[model samples]
Target: MKTYRDYDDLPKIELPYGKEVSISDSTLRDGAQMPGIVMRSKHKVQIYEYLHMIGIEKLETFVYNERDRKAIKLMQDKGYEFPEITGWARANPADIDMVLNVDGIEETGILMSVSDPHIYDKMKLPTREAAQEKYLNALQYAVDHGLRTRAHIEDMTRADNYDFVFPLVEKILEIDPDCTIRICDTIGYGIPFMNVDEPYGIPTIVKYLKNELGAKNIETHCHDDFGLAVANSLAGYWHGANWSNVTYLGIGERAGNAEMEKLLVFLKRRIKGFEKYDLSCLVEFAKFMEKEIGIRIPRNKSVVGQNVFAHESGIHTAGVIKNPFTYEPYPPEIVGGQRNFLIGDSSGIEVLKFKVQETLKEMMDVHIEVDKNDKRLRNIQADIQRLFNEDERVSCISDEEIRAYVKKYFMFNPIVDQELHRREDDESPDNTI
Candidate 1:
């Protein structure tokens, strides 16, 4: 029998994605649009560095203000080839000029609201033709200025693909054959299923863009209003899209976009060419977002959460104590995380003994191996159960409390006491033990 570390041993999905498929981050642009979140120039620069460290190929940002320009300058000064900084703008010369003013930005996303609601209701355009003309003019301006363009077809899931989207995209490709078409599921109305009708079906849309319109590059930018952003993004890639737009922790307007960490982990594990990514920085990135940027990472978040590797229930801990693979899908160290056997009301003697041994080694530089039948370990479990039963305690016991209990039960040992005395004596001026 052979051991399989990842999903390569499982049946694979025959996706139509090319080897050039990659992820583009929107954490600094769309993610910053999340209400109550403010990422200054310095914070944006730090995030750019982290994204580069995680092997992100590209990242887009708003270059509409001095702060945005300063952040771009700082990131460019670092001289990292990956996470190439791009700019976001609306379908107008003024917005494109803002991006043009920022040096080192060779590409910019030109927003084109293709749906009738955005054309008439949002932009107050008289007709669909007017909207198309507006978008084309802006795209041409960007191209003439020597900037690569990405046409963001906003509200695309609800738009008329044949009458409006296909025509506009064809013209966009005519203006610049290299322009990337970014399909935006602005309200998260897109579905991931195949054989679904046009516009709403992500796979259908990507296939149409590649097969019908001859689009050389396509990106998927989905929202999580219905919590299907990642699924829809994958559906687009499975069909033909080359780029998947994402944000850190899915932070963005409304429910947010597809999560970057989640998508990366999935690709690294399931896809063939994605094994080159270094995933060790994922946990560190989550910590940086929480501690430095004041973003609260949900303890139960999929890839980098604090509690993802923690086990408390008796059944789970017992199985994990015998063989970690029995309970965990993958090793914690794969994402730079550690497994923890938390001591709680549901914990059993096995977990208690393990915790005691681990805490002793960490705090006292002593390794005291114990078993489930150890009396001191059983006593500790009994005290915890008593707290839950009598005192109605709900929270797990703290490490300090556990350390104190261990000291009470183990410090009295003759060997331990002698060792402690010897260490104290050696530290004295007399140098005696």
Candidate 2:
């Protein structure tokens, strides 16, 4: 269920979305390409399995090496419950042949370097001729092999204008319009500049392509040389791009590819009239990747971060105490996270009182009137805050403990002196302050 209150009440924008932006996690392949990164075949298999359980609609299993191809084949033979399996390849017949020989990868993406520099420097050919030939040949190869094709136009941000890309896409469509097209921000060079105040705009240049292309299959591949890759991906979807090439924790070449977790949350919360994707297992998958793959998730990283749900401001805490929605944009519980109230020396007494009251209420079903001048309650609150700050402990006192302590203090004002070194034990009748 949608946890945010305003999701349904959001004002409708009649922006035409072409193909649904499907996710393709490339954790095994592209994620492995990052320097000093490697995954055991078993872990790779687990990643694929977990992706399906998380409701990722597609899986691009990276380059088709013998070991990788074997893994993809096993998944195909085993019949994954979700994520239609696919592989990535250079825009060449040999590459396509590698994927075709895999026997069960339902789709294969052929990455063609369509930019002028790549054409001239890498391929030693003119942009137009090299692009058309590579794209056409790769498409035909995949088609003849009975595999769906995704034509990856690499370095598209720097590629010669739509005049080149559009024609190439048109020709590929002429051969097979059903083939998916990947508009890559290879260097993260594509800037969606809006007005001066909002320099980063939406329905980006890539989005415009997907919009113009309409239903002729499209996807997105982005790099984060600049930090705008995620923003670009979101804008792409809002405009029209349907397929998102992603990696675990955004791990890939350079700054990495689009973050799969960030994309899932954005779609779940931001998109209108969009449904049918399951995301409950995303946090579990992220934790697995962190533990097994050794990718350290930053504390401030989006939904799955260590501190994403941690709150500390007094005003924010008080508002949250009233209604979490007042301070939080969305309920942390929606993403398998809980709201945290961190008390410290800077926290005011009112906030501290509310925190203790809230903790007591949660710990027990009883209601006790706390006096402001009660020195014992003040000391307990101070201890609670101290313990929380120094050792990260919160509310060590249980309901029974609270009842026993509060009843003893309120009824008899137990300890006669403030400086008494008291060690009370609940389990033993003789052990007391």
Candidate 3:
């Protein structure tokens, strides 16, 4: 049963999405490649369980060497279900042998470079034919050795589909009709908009693979060099492709791949059948990864970011008090997150009224009714604006500071009075700014 929260009246896509969307997580392979990011074997296994909890469709592990093999074995030994593991390797006999040595990898991706850049610039092949020969030899070797294969066609958008890509795809399918094709948008050069003639258009690429060339289970692997990875992945599904290759935090080479959380949410919004997913675990996973590795998720980062559901502006916060749906697309619980109304210099009277009432009610252990038009609240907002904008120049006014102000003001009149000693602050980049 698909469950929806907050969106009692969801903006449903009445137009039929003809194909089922599949997700393939590549956090271990690609996300680990994020500069200065590292994941030990234990962390990888834990991440796998979390991914499984969120309904990850599949997962990939690179069988590059003995260390990679050992790590893969350790992860598999832990036995958490869902997200069937597949091996990733360049199209070659040696790579195939490495993957085959892994205890339980049932499939592997064949990195077949089909573009002029990959063929000549990267592979240094004299001709497309020569490149195809090398690729075919490896493809034959992988399929013949009892491993199901998928072609990760590197630099796909830059390649000529009619001239070379289609012909090579046809030959690969002729060798094994069940082989899947993973179109690699290497360097993030592809656009997500529809256009068959546009070489780098996602719709065209998926269409040529599925409709023109008769490929099976077409997948997309997009990079975020131009910030279109998620869009391109969605485009693949829109054009009848099945799998979206994603990383936990869009972690990959350079700008990274499509973010698993964002992509899954995108699909859940349009296509049904994700109600049972425990999306709350995603934030836990992201936070754990950030700490285990030394990377910090930016406050403004999408989905799992600390501030994605945080509201500061008075207009938004005031509206949020009325109906969160008026100010937000979905409830924070949709992804198992919390909504916070941050009191900053930009905060308004309405929000101040709400915040003051809530804070005093909790602190005083009483039902505190705050006046929206309270002169004290207006004075507080003005003081906050002055301090936030000019005097202290802080990004936000802390709750303690608000409490102190309220206590001080009440001391002058009748509410309450207390001056608490402030503690020395710890170092954090997010503290001041």
Top lDDT hit? 1
- Residue-wise lDDT of candidate 3 within 77-108, one digit each (tens)? 76856778898888779888988888788898
- Runs of candidate 1 with Cα error greater than 4 angstroms are 1-14, 413-433
lDDT of 3 at 249: 86
What residue pairs are clashing in model 1? none
So what's the TM-score on candidate 1? 0.91
TM-score attained by model 2: 0.79
lDDT of 1 at 81: 95
lDDT of 2 by residue, 1-433 (tens): 5454443544444336544557877777678887766787777778878787777777777645667866776676657767777778887888877776766667888877878888888888765786688678878878887888888878877866556876677778777778877778888875655331111233455555555655466677778889877877776666676677888689888898888878777777666655666676667777888888888888788888866776666677677776766767566766777777665544554555555565556656666555555686776566656666786654334445444545455444654443243533544477764
Question: Over 4 Å off in model 3, which ranges?
Answer: 1-6, 14-17, 196-198, 274-276, 415-433
Q: What is the C-alpha RMSD of each candidate to the true structure, in Å?
A: 6.5, 6.9, 8.9
TM-score of each: 0.91, 0.79, 0.90
- Predicted structure 1: lDDT: 0.88
Error of 3 at 314 (Å): 1.0
- What's the lDDT for residue 192 in model 2? 50
Which candidate gets the maximum TM-score versus the true structure?
1
lDDT of 3 at 61: 85
